[model samples]
Target: MTYRMLALSIDGTLLRSNSRLSRQTKDAIEYVKEKGVYITLATERPFPAAKKIAKALKLDNVLITHDGGFIASDVDEPLLSRKLHEDKTFHIAEILENYKCHIRLLHEQFSIGNKVRQKNQLIARMTLGIQDPLYYPVTFVDSICEHLMENPVAPPKIQAQFFSAEEAQAASMELQKEVPSIDTIVRGERLEIVPKGISKARGVQVVANHLGISLEQVVAIGAGVNDIDMITQAGLGVAMGNSPEELKASADWITRSNDMHGVAYMVKEVFRKQLKVNI
Candidate 1:
């Protein structure tokens, strides 16, 4: 089938292991765009962080960021945004406080969290390991629950970082049972909690509706569990070779890893035929 749009996940799919974009990948994206295919990023990052990547890629389409909670272009207002209720956000924080984790509340453009350096030092190390322009802007307060209680505003999502995958999974299971209204997604030791029904697939649907395209004409590439919905929902779902086994099992095709310019390989090898491009 013919494809008109491409939705990509930034962290593990587009960016290399060092969190930098390769020249071949950039050129391939530009080439696909020249062939009349629209491309945009769908990530768990907020707008400020995602915008930098979009700019570097020269993408002009609306981006699906905040794990599908916010969608907008550089020039336009957010076409769609889903925020958690203030009470729900506070309750989530309260529940998370029982675990040995660092919690960060995600706003539209920035993130705020409690100062638990000891608990989240590993996350800091992981963040420092990645290269420039991929980091999120974060503010640490003394008490995140108290801060939210005093200044109540609906945030799009909450992210928690744990030292071990077991801790993360346990916390996720408890949160899922206690807070059924929220959706929990675990990526290694990082757990993301967003409003129920919010996902990359839903975000893509919003983008598709805005652009007047069909779901069957969309292609999604990602490397994480958060991307599973969109991967299964899109007409062509691609998983990076570096992706988890679960993700690869769900994908229609598996390309090389992100560091090897998997996106470029997918576009040049798999998609070019569908687009009917000789170049």
Candidate 2:
């Protein structure tokens, strides 16, 4: 089968356990690009966070970020964007405060989050890779709900980190019940909320159309439950070995864990005849 496009999920799929890219992975991507394959990142992160990884990979192609709610390579110009209106944002924030979860709103370039400093409070997944103060400035507010009440923010999505998975699950359920039009994705103790119909599947389809390719020519690799849609929609879907059994069950193949450089292993295996295993 000839694949024209390769879509990768960040975090556990593209990066290692320590949140770093490997030399082997870089070489594999270069090999595939030389093979005339297009590469892009499909992630739940905002553009700034995902763009940092793209810079490491040296890929300037359009990226699918914010769980498919936003897509663009350059910050100023966006090929596509889907964000929650301010009213919905405020309502979601109101619901989240009940659980005492650390909440953050994800914009295309900037970030607004609550100043959560307490025991067992999640630090928003190691700050969620937004370290560039000049490029991706993050604001830590005292109360996100109050901030929204005073000012409106149109964000692609919102993320909440809980102290326990049970709390996360409960929050997800309540949010879904209250806002039936929204979508909730639970990863361990983190709960990611996005507007309805916004998904990686939508992102992939948009990128495919932008690249003028068919879905059958795309290979999706992911490790998170939020990634299920794209993984299921692609011609070839792969799950990392460290992923949950349910996520693995959705994949057409299972590769090594993130620590073992699963993406490099899988890519090399697929194009072994054309690309060498060793860098």
Candidate 3:
């Protein structure tokens, strides 16, 4: 067997502790590249945050980000994108407000919020550290709310993220009742909401089509609930040993935990075990 494309989820799947890529992960990716496989990263991170990782692998290729709301290449050109309906965006804000959910409206990383929570502050730090071009500070918390209230126009929601898992699940359930036309998932503890019919799997299809590779030739690996769609859709889904039970169940194979070089192990598995396409 042989795989023509590999679509990898970031966060728990690729990065190790501290949101940084390990030398081990880098070397594994580099080795795969050397073996002439087309590697494309699929991430919920915006292009700016995703680019650095792709660059580290010296992979000048296209990748997906913002769940399935955005796709771009090594350069800043858009390949595909989708936005939530404006009415739905406003409706979600209204519903979540009643639940006292701390929310942020993201349009390519330009976030508007009632207040800047610790999580937003952390994301800002990470964005700045990576020098992400899509990153921008819209306004102070109070000003942002004031502007939204006065404008009365729904912003294009590239991403709407909740700061907590419990709150997100609650909000997701509520939104499902009022408006089910949205794609929602959990990235780590954060709840991510995107336009309906958009997801990492859809993103994978786009990249696969571009490469002329069938879905059966793609392998996706992940560790969180957010990766469920990607894991199930890929031909051979591999879960990290540390992944949640539900996620592990969705995967066709499981490997060592991330801290134990799970990615390296899986890379070797593809070449030496599953595909037997010796590197």
Candidate 4:
């Protein structure tokens, strides 16, 4: 039962509690790769963060990043991208401003414009020993109106994340009630605002097309609502055990919790049981 490919999601799926892969998980993934399985990742994380994990796994593969907004082999130069229409991007910013909510706009490697200042508290909370906010210098948008009028090249922002999920859900629901065209969903701690019908599932399809792999041969795993599309698309959609019930219900299988080394568990199960590709 050899798999043509395996596309894993990051965050709550692969990386363990400390935001790092455990030895077991690392070895299991490496083992499957040794068995000639094509391994890749689909993540909402920007290329910078995604690449590090890819290299760590020694997968020697490209990633689908920006929730599938861009696909780059080097993670430096994208091969394909689905950017939001400029006017739509502008409206997104305006919506956030009108709602009196804070937002951040990502450019190439880091943020291009900031909607709100990054106070120490915000920075500390974002980092949370999981990531270094200082890894990339972020610019503040300051005035929402100014950014829209200036139209300073939105450049296909990877994500527009709100500070909190509940707040994002609430705000997005309100916006959609008014606009009826807005697409908003939680990705980890933030709510992602994108033009309707854009998602990691669409992103992975871009990657799959480039690789000549059909959805039937590509397995995907994740733990968040944002991951629903990808999970629904994969040949084997695996949900993390700790994921919300809705997500689990949508998955083909549920792996262990992230803290319990779930990624490693599934890596072993897939190869040993399902794929039957000895490692």
For each candidate, how many residue pairs have backbone atoms clashing (under 3 Å)? 0, 0, 0, 2
**All candidates: CA RMSD (Å):** 3.3, 3.9, 4.6, 3.9
What would the per-residue lDDT of candidate 4 be over residues 1-279, giving only the tens digit for each residue?
346678888888888767778888888787778766677788766666677788888876767776676667674668766665666666666676755345655544765544344443333123212432345665565665576577645544424455566666776676667554446665545556555666788877877787787888777889887788888988889999888899999999999998898878887787765543421
lDDT sort, best first: 2, 1, 3, 4
Q: Which candidate achieves the best lDDT against the true structure?
A: 2
Find the 10 residues in a row with the least total lDDT in model 3: 123-132
lDDT (C-alpha) at residue 119 in model 4: 49
CA shift at 214, candidate 2, in angstroms? Answer: 0.9
Instruction: List ranges where model 3 is wrong by over 4 Å.
Output: 74-76, 116-138, 143-145, 149-166, 186-189, 272-279
TM-score of 1: 0.89
lDDT tens digits, residue span 30-132, model 1: 8888778878899988777788888899987799988898888952388988889999888888988988777878787667776566633533423312322
For each candidate, what TM-score against the reference? 0.89, 0.89, 0.80, 0.81
lDDT of 2 by residue, 1-279 (tens): 778889999978888888788898898888887877889999887898889889988899999998999999898889998888888899999999888667888888788877666676644433533222235777888889889888899898999888799999999999999876789988778889998999988999999998788898789999888778798999899899888888899999999998898988998887666432111
Clashing pairs in 2: none
Error of 4 at 109 (Å): 2.3
- Report the alpha-carbon TM-score of model 2 versus the true structure: 0.89
Q: Total backbone clashes of model 3?
A: 0
* lDDT, each prediction: 0.82, 0.84, 0.70, 0.69
Clashing pairs in 3: none
Residue pairs clashing in model 4 are: 114-140, 114-141
